[model samples]
Target: MMTCIVIDDEPLARSLLAQHIADVPFLEHRGSFKNALLAADFLSKNQVDVLFLDIQMPKLTGIDFLKSLQHPPKVIFTTAYREYAVESYELQAHDYLLKPITFERFFTAVSRLQVATPKVIETPIPETATTPEHIFVHVNKKHIKVILEDVTYIESIKDYLKIHTTKETLVIKERISHFIEQLPNPPFIRVHRSYIVNRDHITAFTQQDIEIGDIEIPIGGTYKEEVLNILKAP
Candidate 1:
């Protein structure tokens, strides 16, 4: 269970969050505080995975309090004010909730936290200057050596994925879902329901398409925002 703490000056706000916490099976509400100081003390004495924070308080606001913590836990800011939205995200907060938070919104935030949670993989990746440039994959039950730099993109063919290299597009029988996780981040990103491309190899991008080599692939609408952010990173 994720140990959680609620910090709000108002009693009604604290009570509401406590009720919400009880609904989420995995969340264990430790206590509620009227100010950041009391919450800070509780945090020092115990462990907390998530913090339900209110931005406006008498002495010190939630934003200032959070900034004070050397190592703050995953925070979901709750406030009546809308101005703090961008500021909260800049702090890498889990979610931002406008006061009078509904059960559905709380549930959505919790679900998002699950995806964003950091996992310590047992098989550590080798320390290197660059992501793997060469790897091996079994294709048609035969072990095939592949150079990453030569790969233009990948396409999910139902259960299997076809890895496209400059010389050849090899059909690998491995599940697309599993292969996606194994693929390195950044340069390789899923741009559509069936396509993942090498960002470095991309020649041009538009609202509808991305150009890799001479091959043009349609960018899915759902992935557009993230794809645009990735493309803009350079």
Candidate 2:
């Protein structure tokens, strides 16, 4: 079972989340706190599998508290503000739930957490084995295998992602955040909120945009530093 804690100043919100936790068979509710400071203290002494954190709180805001952690647990941000969504993703939050959260929505978020969690393979790898060169994605009720080397870029369109390969573009109904976690690093890097480009395909780049073939993708302000570092790496 996955152990979790709720950190929110609102009494009603805490109570409601506690009830939801009890309803989930795979989730064990460890504790609930009214502030980030209290939660930090508890976290220092113990570890949990997941954290349901509020974005805004007195003394220390949730975002600031999360940033302070050297090794943070999987976090699901529970907040009333929609503006914090982008920042939450930048922090690699497991999920974001808006205030007045329903049981259905909460379930969906946890379900995603379960799916995103990496599984361990006990089978041993051969000494000469190499990493898989392709990834399979579900599209139109069929699993389509994509060559990693051929992918030029990925574009997020609402709830779906457009995977642009050397041959063609495939539209898959999946979140960009999900792809970010699943895709291999090095060649793939998120340049913008809506774009993930293959560094191998990048013929040119600037502080403002990245050029892959003839398509120029904007570099988000928040992602500039990481993008530049990756591009400059030897």
Candidate 3:
């Protein structure tokens, strides 16, 4: 079993993470602390496998705290901020989670600690049943229905996402990664950190970028190889 801890300034955040740890069969909740300073002392005394850390704490931010540790454990950053995403990944963070964590997302992050190749837990379907064709997203003040085939691409704008479709562009307050989890893979693929393109709508492509009609989206360096492989697949 892997021993873990939650370090967040907010009491509610700490409590929520601790509860998540409890739910995971392999994770043993060692303790929960309100600050990184308190967790520092605990780390010195104990053996921790994972840390569910919050970025915007009072005394020392989560990024600084991880840098200070000579032998830090696998860390999963939990915060509302999207700006620190690059820095956290640079530090080799296990995963990054945005605020108001859902149990599904939380489980996905923590599951990585146990497996090298993590997968989405799929529910077995009956032979006659069909997959969903559309998804409802919260846009403006109401749930908007968007057909899967209608979406051309999705762009990340800070904490919000701009979903471009054949008919309209719908703006929604959500993380691009979280939003992508709802869509099927073959038709929808992430081309860059800031963009997810529908392969069916892709008109053209080069090693550096992909073109969907007139708009061109740059392929991220790290994702280029995989993106090209998918695009070239028969």
Candidate 4:
């Protein structure tokens, strides 16, 4: 699911927008806030795929709020007036959803997000149809066999993950974010600013950190909530 948050002041505006988001099956509201500063702090601490922003806030205009981000996500500007429409697009907003946002328009913006999302290809093996164990990665001029369960974690070093398995760690050059597409979910979760861990391998954990073998990985501040929920879930 794509994590999202709404930044708007009016109670009625939030009520209406909340209904529109609820209509989308994939979106889950992380939370909502009235102040841009608070929103900025939340964005810094969390991984947000989409931002539903309102332009005419008191301290910070939505335009200025986005302009300040180092790496902005898909934005949908919400406001009463249309003067900011062209300027909003110039800022690379996915879509400008006018206030009193209709369900149809909201779906349109989400559909664009689907287009921008990365793609993956998976092939089923014969006997392992139910329990696929191995995957092949081309590294150092040869096809290597990696038992997925043996992997401890994957760390991003700019372009590639130094794939740390029980036997060895391979430095295969690929998109860190894109390469993550190849990994199976569930047993693994991206838990830090630059690391993903095999949840099954977690030996111990704390409110501040997790332990796997000799490694003590610190969780990102924003990812704490989901990490805790995953740990608590049956």
The candidate scoring highest on TM-score is: 2
The list of candidate 4 runs beyond 4 A from truth reads 119-234
Q: Sorted by lDDT, highest first, which candidate order results?
A: 2, 3, 1, 4
Weakest ten-residue segment in model 3 by summed lDDT: 112-121
Clashing pairs in 1: none
Model 4, position 84, has a per-residue lDDT of 89
The residue pairs in collision within model 4 are 45-222
Candidate 4, 1-234: lDDT as tens digits = 677888898878877888888888878888888968999999888988888899999999889999899898778888998998767754557677777778888898787676566544366546744544777887989988899899998887755678889899988875344445467777777776567888889898888888899999888765687787897788
Query: How would you encode candidate 3's per-residue C-alpha lDDT over 27-91 as one tens digit per residue?
Result: 89999999999999999999888889999999899999998998998889999999998878646
Model 1 earns a TM-score of 0.55
Candidate 2, residue 134: the lDDT equals 94
lDDT of 2: 0.91
Candidate No. with top lDDT: 2
Clashes of each: 0, 0, 0, 1
Positional deviation of residue 127's Cα in model 3 after best superposition, in angstroms: 5.1
Give residue 130's lDDT in candidate 2 (0 to 100): 65
- The CA lDDT at 141 in model 4 is 95
Query: What lDDT tens digits, residue by residue, belong to model 2 across residues 25-140?
Result: 98999999999999999999999999999999999999999999989999999999999998898777888999899999999999888887766568996799765689999988
Candidate 1 total steric clashes: 0
